[model samples]
Target chain A: MPHERVIRHGRVEPDAWRFVGLDEGEDLQALPHGAIVVPLAVWKARRDALLARLEPLGVWLEPHDEPGEIAADLPRLALVAVRFPKFTDGRGYSTASLLRRRYRYAGELRAFGDIGRDQLFYLARVGFDSYRLPEHRDPEAALAAFGDFSLRYQGSVDDPVPLFRKRAAVEVRHG
Target chain B: MYRYDEHDRKIIAERVAQFRDQTRRFLAGELSEDEFRPLRLQNGLYIQRHAPMYRIAVPYGVLGSRQLRKLAAITRRYDRSYGHFTTRHNLQLNWPRLEDIPDILAELAEVEMHSVQTSGNDVRNITTDHFAGIAADEIADPRPYAEIVRQWASFHPEFAYLPRKFKIAVNASAEDRTVLKLHDIGLELRRNDAGELGFRVHAGGGMGRTPILAEVIRDFVPWRHVLTYCESILRVYNRYGRRDNIWKARIKILVKTLGVEEFRARVEEDWAELQDSQNVITDAEYARVAAHFAPPAYEPPSDDDQAFAYAVASDRAFARWVGRNVHAHKRPGYAAVTLSLKRAGTPPGDITADEMDLVADLADRYGFGEVRVTHEQNLVLPDVRERDLHDLWQRIRGARLATPTVGLVGDIISCPGGDLCSLANAKTLPIAEALLQRFEDLDYQHDVGELDLNISGCMNSCGHHHVGHIGILGVDKNGSEWYQVTIGGRQGREAALGHVIGPSFAAAQMPEVVEKLIATYLEHRVDAERFVDTVERIGIAPFKTRVYGAGKELARAA
Candidate 1:
């Protein structure tokens, strides 16, 4: 359990990326140079200008945003954070999977907004390395949820090969 | 029943511990109702009218003797000495303290059972015909496939939360005993021209305020691709199923909006990618699961068992029971017996702890130590030898389970109405009792014959009133309990939703209204046509006219 720690893949690390929402309307250039995340629209509009800077860049994606556009910018962006407008809506999980698997974006992937602590295990399995738990929730207690289940049946972004294939591989190996 | 492997056991054990922590957080004032609602729902805990009702999924409704004993003990310890079997083929303990649920779930896990996804927005316990593996007409056993689906859907990362509660039912026989068209995903196992086992997949079927039957999404998907196909459908539903309005959030509404042709196209597109995934079922895996369900030992009888014939000939009551309760098995010497949980003067599926313990013992003695909970909320010994039928009947009779009303009028499917549920608009138990009283004559009920009478507390259709031959839906009119009756519904291969006869009637008038409909059916000149068939043949005109006698205000509410 990464108690009081932030997860980046299988390792625990201090969170470095700072979130900037769509409605915040802040000037992206004024934010901390390397740790800044602007909305997907802003990143799409000013991709060349943002990439010209001498620092790693980030873009935030919501469930409704076009994640396909990020494929070309995968090498440019250091962090990709997915936002869920509501806890009940799970489209962002799929969006994260596509970003990691289809787009092959291996940079830091984070989940924020309306994504509760209870969803951490699933989000982690689906290739989310970081989470910004809603303001009221405690991150320490939420860490226990990460190691709640050790086995997963289906393949996701983090583990492209599913458990059954691995199980069969082990059986063949031992034999 | 599929025996749990290390993978299965580990997952279930971890889930119990996870839920224990969740319950602690919920009680410690750390998790609000809003935050904990879905979490508690995933564990099958609901805060009903009187108290919390915890429902445990009886996966495919098959339980070993050990599991049955565990359930009996749980109910005996934590609840009102009994549990209610639901239409989804799950069990509900009516009066468990909120805090005791984690313990109940832990105990359930020890028995290789848990209530996970039983009452959540995710996929529910997969249901099938009680006589699934042993049915004479079945092409293949659907249990292995059902078990695969159950494991695949458990704790699904993407679909843990969906637009609404989803249900799936599997049927292998030509007969649709599980009400195939009335679930979110209905899988009917079949064989193609080349005699390869496949599935006829249907999606977007549900019954609530709006009841829409499923459309065939795939005519034939081979057994190897079942999980991948299911994933495609679910992922598409997760992507496009309505999330704005809870009332219209079911897959049925989505199919209605998108058109089945377009919906099928979307699922096919998803399936195109999923086919290459590791979700596919190989022969090795299928055989391992099939080994668990392979038939038990059987001893063949002579041309005719004189002892059995003598018992059936001598005991009139036993003969009647054999006719109604005994279903022919694929194995000639073995038969499946439906133990009626629909005894008169009690809520339809309420079986006491003592009754469960007795049934467990009965399963051990007569059955091959297996009991199946039917979607109709009855129990079955799926592999009872025909030679031991008389002896089994005697034990069941002693336990008040041999009701001789398996598919008869008295075998009513009902929901925990206003009596126990906060969501119920009216109480259905009292109404059930009144009907049972009016038709207590065993011979008279037998004469009525083959009536699928189902009653729901409201239009939620938990009792599956939509597919009943005689459907009763309770309504709230000016704080008074009223019921609307529907007729001409059937659940098998050619499933159809029942149509409302006319205006709703007061609770007092329900029994008489039903009696008038039955009288109309009796008076019609039909030779051996069942009640639903008669209603379908002649239309609802005759029955409606008799029930609303001379009242011009009546209009069909179909």
Candidate 2:
């Protein structure tokens, strides 16, 4: 097997889980023996059967799929992967925010597909903990992107306080 | 004149560093052209017809003398000896190299400016009334709110990769100087019955291939909830705005499809949830930004200067310039002066390195150490003292910046057309030059009286042809260029789009067609009615008849 690199919490690590049934006719039965991730439709169709297997399980979603579809299943999953399809297709960002902020999903969240070095900083800010860099790119070099900006002005999933509020707090403390 | 704090400084520095790496990667062939296009565009670098163009944001049209001087230095070093001031109140360097842009952005950060979000699918530079603080009829200063929104929209993680480019404009003056109704989101400051400040917001209006005026979605959103309200509107646009077709991707089409009432309902639902979030603007934060825009120190009003009165009486040129270029100020002893960029021979908003340096020096010497870029593509010395009018005029004339045609026929706003922009259908500068040559006599321009003529190379409306009193649009038929004329569009209180007069004309006949329209207006006016007013009253019938009826005469004249 080829070595797959996953960036989690700004560090490179091996990806333990395998994604299954990504293609239209891929078999859901007789899956790999280790950790496995299923598609959203497959998870909905064979929820109890997949749960009965007991090995680590996760679900992945397409860009247009609603995060609310997996809200009740959050507690049963070990990971949730959101596919970007294209870096410019930004509907996934809102989906990530809704999954983390509204649904309060605390498991590992990963971003896959068209994830470039330039997108890592913004992805991390909106609550994605793991990134599967495309195969041709260097995951080690892309790790530097997370530190690209030392400060951000607006609130995000990483930090809920905007810069102005923080500055105002500092002013009050000093006074 | 909003100064950068530690947070602002660090963010801009980091953005410069980030862009430097992106440029390096692209040059090394690691990033494809498709991948690099949006990244470079977000940093305000466009691959124009001749070379790379860099646009620098002049936030809310405000510029400090030091900042303007820095821009002059940048143009001198990184580009041709000049820059073009756009209708959106930003400055564009037409000939910068791709390798030199990161250095340019680093230099910009030293003066508290950046090209971030200047041109991209993300939020653009927030624009407001040029006379934001000094306008006599404003309910309250809009700069503080504009600053707040600017910070919120900067590098916003969720809205960064929007379906299409978005623009937001703020206005507080009674006259709507920023063309509020033509923006994706327009906020007008108002005071409720309880004397508390808030905004009357309009959403989903834009000008491009399709032009639609924005409808007021909310009558009142409290001051503290402005950020949340805007966030709600943006979220709705980002999630559902059409991504299938690039031409139909703007928020204007989305609003039109869903109907304004349904769009408002969806936005209200989002706002109701976000109102109590940490995104709310705190009182302390509002005070922090508002303090930066407070009234500047001014000496008390004194008796009118005798020399100014004498110069006005003796020199008709000086008197006419004052009548057209000077505007009333909220303070008694001060006045806002527009330094015209529309000289007879030059393209409308093009200013040279020497001109930029000279304007900075004048701003420092005659007024506060600040200047404004108006949406009309001119510069403003926002707080010039009335007592120094004569000396300022003489000094301004030394640079040929004193063109006494502020709103007259000679003052034409035009885009960088087929000459530079790859998207243009025809060349706009030659048409503008012909019009200027025909009206070269300043006496004739003044007699024409307060006519707004705007030209666009295409329907993208970068020159704002939709709102001009007499708008000219460039078109292409077969392989040759043609010009279409529209009359009666106006921008201020009751804004409306112009009506197309008839079929298009060749480039050579543009000047004659405009002259015939002007002749009709001159003949039909009662008292000193403006061209737009006359067109509105007599309608397009008589003007169309005059131009199309005398085709043989026009052919002979041509």
Candidate 3:
């Protein structure tokens, strides 16, 4: 199995996990314990069914909602999954922020779907901890996205301090 | 104008350092062009046709003398010694090296300013009427609310990267100087029966390849929920707004696809969840922000200004200026003066270094040490005492800033088209000069009664030619200059795009074509009907018949 990063809420740690994609009406009962992936539409439609099934196996399911929908389920779930859907659909970004700040969901937040190298930094800021890109994409490229910018103009998940507070610290150090 | 408190100052300073580090990383090649693109854009730095253009935010079009001087110094030090004031109440410097931008931003930060969110797909500088605090018809000063929105939208994590650029404009006056209908989100401040301030929210209005007039989404959203509600709208747009096609990327397209009713439903649904969260403004926070923009210590002055009247009567030039430049202020003895840049031969909104410094000094002496930049591309003194009009006129005249033609034919709004902007197809300044030459009579212009003559280099409509009463759009015909004339466009409360009269005219014949149209309007108009009202009444048929007839006649004669 390839190396995997396990994210439960805002924290990241290494874990031995395998990919388990779910199809519509597929019995998730056969899935391995821990965490599993599901489509956003299917998850929304059968949330109760999947929750009931997963409760017995000690597995948590990550429902990838479109970015704006994440705020609706705020303060309830411990872990929410966001999907890139496509390389460009930025809905996941707003979803992650809504989940983190608006809902105050402190559980694991994982990013799956069309996650790739270019979007790692932004995903991190919006409160995504573990990234699950496609098998073909280079993990190094995705990891490099984390260090693209040394500074950010606004506050985000990666740093709770607003840009102003960060700048004041720098000013004091230099002044 | 909103004074910066410690929180505001700290925010701007932090943004500067963040941009500086981004610039450093970009230079070090740690960040590729694709990676650094949005980051730099959020800081208001754009690599345009020639060099990087830095757009500095002037919230609600208000600036102090100190800020203006700082801008002047920045231009002198780093840029090409000039800056262009945009329709969104921001200033743009066309040529600045990439490495020098951080220094420029740092200088801007010194004056409590930043270019944050001025560009990119994020929320842009929140704009309001240039006459926000001073307009006579204003219900309340819109800047405080505008400043509040500015803080809420600034560096917002969720809406930072939308499908396309977002613009929000607030209009507090009956006369919509901010052109509320042409923005992505327009908030009109109105009072209910209880005299509580609320906003009539209009959504999805924009101009580009696809121009759209906004639809009323909410009749009354309480002023306190302004930030939370706006966040909800932006959140919806960010998630569902189209990103597949660049042309179809704006919230306007999403609003159009979903329809206003469905869009409003989704927004209301989103707001229902977020309203009680931290996004909602607390009463204490509201008072804190509002206090920064509280009205300055204004003492009631004697209304009797016999001296100014005497001065104006004594000097013919001064009288023309006072008649044209002076505007009714909200205060009893105060007047707002517009220093026109529409001199006959100069570029429409181009102010030289000397002129800028001179204006800065005038702002310090005559006004309350503050200056404003209008969307119409003019400078304003928001609080000039009626008693000081004559002395102010003399100072402005000495600097050649007294153009005595605000809202006249000479007060044309021309884009820096083909000469500067790479997107432009034809030259706009020459046509503006031609119009100025033809209409030398101030008495004739004042009689013409408030015509907006706008010229754009191309259909990109940066000059907002679509909404000009007499719109001139530049077109390229067989590699030579050609112009298209449109009539009936207006940008006020009843905003409407102009209709093209007929075939395009050659460069030489533009003055004659415009003159004929004006003459037609003068002849056909019912008593006191402005150009727009006349065109609305008579339709574009008569003007088309006259202009096309003249075009045909000129062609045959040629």
Clashing pairs in 3: A8-A108, A9-A107, A9-A108, A67-A91
DockQ per candidate: 0.56, 0.75, 0.24
TM-score of every candidate's chain A:
0.84, 0.96, 0.66
lDDT tens digits, residues B92-113, model 1? 9889999998899889888899
Give the per-residue lDDT digits (tens) of candidate 3, residues B241-335: 88878888988898999999999999998788755554455565556556777666666987665898788789987887888888998888888
- Residues A1-175 of candidate 1: C-alpha lDDT, one tens digit per residue: 1133455564545667666555455665565555678788778777787778767678998777767888987888888988888887887877776787668788888888887678999998778988877657767667777899998877666665666676677778998
Q: Indicate which candidate wins on DockQ.
A: 2
Model 3: CA > 4 A from native: A4-38, A41-80, A85-88, A97-106, A112-127, A132-175, B303-305, B441-443, B475-482, B506-508, B550-558
For B338-369, candidate 2 gives per-residue lDDT tens digits of 99998867899999999999999999998889
Looking only at chain A, give the TM-score of model 1 against the true structure: 0.84
Candidate 3 chain A: minimum summed lDDT over ten consecutive residues — where?
A: A55-64
Interface RMSD, one decimal, each candidate: 1.6, 0.9, 5.3
Model 1 CA RMSD to the hidden true structure, in angstroms: 2.8
Each model's Cα RMSD: 2.8, 2.2, 5.3
> Candidate 1, which CAPRI tier?
medium
Error of 2 at A143 (Å): 0.7
lDDT of model 2, residue B284:
90
* lDDT of model 3 at position A90: 67
